[model samples]
Target: MTLVLDKLGLARNGEVHLDGVSASFERGSLTTVLGRTLAGKTTLLRAIAGLQPIDSGRMERQGCEFGLLPPWRRDVAMVYQQFINYPHLSVFDNVAFPLRQRGVPDAEARSRTETALGMVGLSDFRARAPTALSGGQQQRVALARALVRRADILLLDEPLVNLDYKLREQLREEFRGLLTSQSDGIVIYNTTEPAEAMMLGDRIVVMHHGRILQAGSPKEVFERPANVAVAGIVNDPPMTILHGRLEDGRVTFGNDVGFPAPKHMDELSRGSYRFGIRATEILPSETGGVIGRVEFSEVSGSETFVHVVTPLGEAVMQLEGVHHVLTGSQMRLSFRPERLFAFNADGEGELVRAPTTGEY
Candidate 1:
């Protein structure tokens, strides 16, 4: 089944919330919507679920059903960021609540509840009250409730935001796998973490200012962002954006900063353009590149991130291991022309050239 929206807009209390927002979701694939706070990610989900009224738009399930139905009758389940569980009820009871509301028999409801808890690895804690469980366990109980209902569509709004890092990582993986187990269902999630979306989503939908900036596979979006905002969001530590101009087949950022432009950009007029280079693409060089000073170095166990101040601008470089690169050390950084992404100041331009037939 598919969820369709046409020119959806939502206004609340005299405030224009969403403007001409349109998106469609297909069955059995995880679609992660990435948007910053206040960008209407949750609002869009709410509108689609019928939790909020649409100011002016049309939404429909593939069968043209759900024309006038509340959320409970629409077969759509949602999990919020906070764990909203009944403290006095056992995990089993909490999971069975939805089934009972639908008039399922007692034995069948119990069986479905057990199965749902098993999928989330919470079967052993089925008899415990919500208050006795840990934060992660309570969240699992909430998820089990949604699964027990066998929802036709699942909408998750930052569902793992309250858990710790290890639990969050594990649960996100499990949630993705569980969503795929249903052959006729769709799962739509909203998240701000690019890594999480890259890991869990089959397709990533980048949203900004209530509009979709780009939508593609993780590799496609990462390798070739559609705009500056998308390029900034897809990478960890983000892509370093520098202002420059193309002249004589070379990109000049400042007085001493110059690098050969990739051959793919040969067709563009020799004028101004912006460049985006991920931290992983900047290699530490002794010379033959732009000279810079290490303003600071952040060393994690497996890798070190160095922020360098250059005549052109501040550039962050990711290097493996801690090689005793001290702060204020004189260094040079080189750019990988193939790894660089270019965009125009107007925020609409080709991020990277498409690969040739023999390249891949």
Candidate 2:
């Protein structure tokens, strides 16, 4: 289904929740609403599902108006961050609840329920009670229930937040495979973490302060954020942005360090600017442009984030595989010119691509 959120506005207790959110989800793709807490990700999803009444704008699916339709009336299914299941219902019954309510034949409902359970790897738990399952298993059961409906629009509100890292990683791949292969439906997922959005979304909407700040592919947003807000909030540890000046064809930092300006930035005269680089892209070497001491280091599986306090400021470096980054050890960091982003005084960003740059 082509799900479109048209200028949606909502409020609760006299406080604004959704401030004119307008976006569309194309069929056969996953659109991730990426933002932090209280950024209106949940509110936008509820509004699209018709659970939260919009004060102004309307929800449209496949050219049909949904302002007057209730949750059941819309061909939609939602899996919340919280795992919700009927305690008294068996796994089979829970998965088949929607089909039963729609009065589907017992044989067809059974077939569909079993298929959904199998997709979520819960086929063997059909006869078990919801409470008898582990938290991860129960969340999978809720996902199975949502899938059994075969709704045109599938809404997942941070569905994997409660799962352990290993399981969440496992399910992220599963969700992308299942949802992206569909040519007749779409999945709208909300996430507060950039890593989650990068994994699950074909398209990502960067939301902030109850508004969508930017929308693009994961690579586009990650490599080239729209503004300072997008740069600050999209990453796990966030990007390290240093305010500096564009002077004499070079961008000058706090220390006596400078780098040649990119093509797009050449037009502007020497003035105030902001330069940023992601933690992962900060190349560390024995002798580099910026120097700092290792303040902290953490290892997770094959990845390591080493915090360094440079003359400019403190920044985290994401290194692949585990490295013995001893604390208090001096470190030197350098970055490719194209890997850095240059923003004007007004906060508008210029996306820098390797061997080329563009003013966005």
Candidate 3:
């Protein structure tokens, strides 16, 4: 079912918010909503689920039944950041709560509860209280509850944020696999972390300041961010953007740094443009296109992030393999023209294929 959130707006007290916001999720695909805190991500989810009334705008669920309407009545289940299990209740009872509330027969509820717990590998802890469990286990119980309901549309709000990194990683893998198994439905998850969004989402909806900046596959958003804010958010080290100009059929970065202008950019009448290059595109070398001093280096075993203080500005590089370089070291880097990105000063971005730049 296509879930359309059209022109949604909301207000609370005297504060006005969400001006004409709209987006949608395709049936059966994992569409992860990405944004910073207070970007209206949660509000958007609540609006779609009909948990919060809107001031104006329509939420259209094509062909959905009304008796199947209300939050409990709809084929939807929400998993929150915190474990919402009844601490006094056993895991089994917690998982079975939804079924019991729905008035499912005792025999059927027992069977489904066990199945859901088993799916999350918590069948062994059925009788254990949530307070006795680890944070990860508690979250699993909440997930089990959602599964027992056999929801067609799973709405997850920061579901893994409360767990530690190790537990978060483990749960993320399991969650991805579990959600993947149910391809007949949809998983709409919200995440503030770019790395999590990259790993979990089949399609990413990037939001900033309560509006969607861009929406596409992981590669699409990463390689072709709609603007500078998005470019900085989606990548591991983020894309390196520099103020520059496309003049006389060439793109120049400050004084000595320049590249042949790709025909796509050349065709544009205006000469002013912004330059963007991913860290991988900037290789360290003595004879490369640009040279800079390494102001800072963050080496994380398998990879490194080098912040180069250059004549133009500081450019961050994401490099793989052991990093032997130290801060304050002079480094030279060059990027192929094709790997560079061109954008208008207003923050509109476009990817230029090597030897040719293409407009978005």
Q: Pick the candidate with the highest TM-score.
A: 1
Greater-TM-score candidate between 1 and 2: 1
lDDT of 1 at 47: 83
Global lDDT of model 2: 0.83
Better of 2 and 3 by TM-score: 2
Positional deviation of 131 in candidate 3, in angstroms? Answer: 1.4
Clashing pairs in 3: 338-354, 352-357
lDDT by residue (tens digit), candidate 1, 69-152: 787677788888887898888989999998998899999988888888898888889889999988988988898887777788
| CA-only RMSD, every prediction | 2.6, 2.9, 3.5
Mark the regions of model 1 whose C-alpha exceeds 4 Å error after superposition: 12-16, 63-68, 293-301, 322-331, 347-360
Tens-digit per-residue lDDT, 1-360, candidate 3: 777777878878865556578777778789899988877788877766768777887766775532226765557888888778898899999999989998999999999898888888899999899999998889889988987786778899998887878778777777777876744677899999888898899999988767788899987887668777787667657678888888788888888988777654556654666677778777876674788899989887688888998988888887897687788988988876767667666635544332232432
Segments in model 3 whose C-alpha atoms lie over 4 Å from true places:
11-17, 63-70, 73-75, 180-183, 262-270, 347-360
Q: Candidate 1, which ten residues in sequence have the lowest lDDT sum?
A: 351-360
- Candidate 2, residue 103: Cα displacement in angstroms equals 0.5
TM-score for each predicted model, relative to the true structure: 0.90, 0.90, 0.86
Question: Candidate 1's C-alpha lDDT?
Answer: 0.81
lDDT score, candidate 3, position 77: 85
- Reference-based lDDT, each prediction: 0.81, 0.83, 0.79
